[model samples]
Every structure is written in C-alpha cells, then in structure tokens.
Target: MSFVRTLRQATAADHEMVDAHYGGFALDRQADYRSFLTAHARALPAVERALAEASDLPPWRSRTALLAADLHALDAPIPAPLPFQPGAAAERWGALYVIEGSRLGGQLLARSVPAGLPSAYLAAHHLPGEWRRLLTTLDTHAAGQGQAWQDAALAGARACFALYARAAAIA
Candidate 1:
C-alpha cells in the first residue's frame, strides 16, 4: 500500500494534523499520538519506502522538525526559532519515524538483548529501559517548544541510536 504522499507535500490540513499529533504535556496530544500510531503503524512501511526515496536520514530528520515551522507559520510561540522553511515541519516527524524504524529493524542495532544466552532469547526480550530512554527523550522534546526543531529532532534520533547501540552491545 502507498503511504500518504501528502505528508511530503504538506498541505494546510497536514499542518493541523502534525500539531494535533504532537499534543504533549501542555497540549496533551499523547492520546492522539497513541491512536495515530495504532492506526498508522501497519502502514509505516510505505512511509519508510517513500523516505528511502530520499538520499539519507537527514532529509527525514528535517521532516520531523516540520512542526516547529508550522507553529511559527501559525504564529504559535515556540521557545526557539525554526530551522526550516514554513510548512515543512512534518519532515521532523517523518525523520523521527525513520530513526525509530531503523532501530526497531535492527539495521543499526540488534533488536535483542543478550544475557549470556542464545540469540533467540535475546531477540524475545526487548530492553524496556532502552525503550524508556528513547521514549523519554522523544516525549521530553515533544512536550515543549523549540526553535531548532530539526536540531532537537536530530538530537532525539541520536539518543535513540545510542540506546539501540547499548542494547545491541548487551545482546
């Protein structure tokens, strides 16, 4: 199935969706996020495929930061300035999705933990602590306003990579 190309085109309605998706501590979009993920998770491979059409992770990373730009466009006060063109904020979200997908897929880090046992057992037990760390980082950023959403997104993605790396080492 094809992922929504409108995510790339980023229409006005898309901006509303991005804002709604990240509703966090202040805005409380967490429930929406959960619902969205549950509804969209199965379709993410199409997004990944579309992202792969891009040259590298940075483009996706930039996409994840699209919210900041949108907020700015909408005159929403962010703690910092946005690093991308207006209407392109969802790029950051897309990037975050790509980063997590890579980690989950074990392309960069094994999706298992080794307790001096067989690899199969390791794969069965995902490290909650690692997942927590990644989620916390994401939630932390998702909760607040920022100027450089791209930078923040990159930082969050890096944290996820580190978490996965640690898990892979243990596996």
Candidate 2:
C-alpha cells in the first residue's frame, strides 16, 4: 500500500480522536476558540522544529505566530510554557503530517466561526494545492523507506494526537 494510505490506516483511531476533540464549529464563544488556538500554538512549534532537522523535507512554516496573533487579537491570554519535545526526523514527519494537515480542517472551522470572533490562525496564509503538495512529498519520501520508517512515522502521528488531546484539555 502507499505510504499515505498505510499511515492513514494505521493512525485512523488517533485521527478520529483528535477530530472529535475539536468538536467542529461548536465553539461559539471567544474563550472556546482561544482554547483551540492555544492548544495548537502549544504543540505546533515543537513539531516544526523537529521537522526542520530533516534535510529531505521542505522547511516547516509555523502557524504558532499567527495563532498567537489571533489570541492577542481576541484578548485571550497566551497559554504559557509549551513544553513539547520532538522525536527523530522520520518520526517528526508523522507529527508534521498532523500539524500541517490541521490547516485543511482549519479552513472548514474558519467558515463556521461566528462573526466578531478572530480566525486569523484558521485563515492564515492559505495557498491553493499546498496540502496536496506536502502530502505528495511525504508520500514519496516514505515510500522509499522500510517498515521501520513507516512504523516510526505512525508512532509519531499517534504521539502527536495524544499531545494535542492533552493540550486541548488544558487550553
């Protein structure tokens, strides 16, 4: 099976759990949205940093800055001390998959945000076809490796989901 397919299958439950945690467009209050962005801001930078160590992968563009700006715009207190640690490059790619893919959902969530709420983090700097491009890169890179590589990637993705779950709770 393709790396993307395999990874998706392997991480299906983790993906569902994270998606459930977001709870769609139900965040009617600014406080709720603040928590969402805070959780992402807490975890994304660390994943991006880990991905940065991999020369084969494209440079990671962090949305934490935009998330912070959105929090500030909404007068939400920035969550303190995002203490996430990253794994090796292959593992980090799995984590990056989750982080970068969030933008796809962010676009959907942005549309559901009630007017008067800040959504800069959700709507930040989107480019057409970017997700597909990144997926292709990841798929191509992973396809060349052995099962160990794919397993590491799967583990990384699962770990990221759990991390996000905890952050969401605290946020």
Q: Which residues of candidate 2, in runs, are more than 4 Å off?
A: none
Reference-based lDDT, residue 55, model 1: 46
Each model's Cα RMSD: 18.9, 2.0
What is the TM-score (0 to 1) of candidate 2? 0.89
Which one wins on lDDT? 2
Clashes of 1: 15
- lDDT accuracy of residue 10 in candidate 1: 32
Q: Candidate 1 — which residues are off by over 4 angstroms? A: 1-95, 98-100, 103-147
Query: What's the CA error at residue 112 for candidate 1, in Å?
Result: 15
lDDT value for candidate 1?
0.34
Q: Lowest lDDT 10-mer window, candidate 2?
A: 80-89
Best by TM-score: 2
lDDT of 2 by residue, 8-106 (tens): 888889888888777742666777777777777767766666666777675557787788788888777776645555555678888888888787778
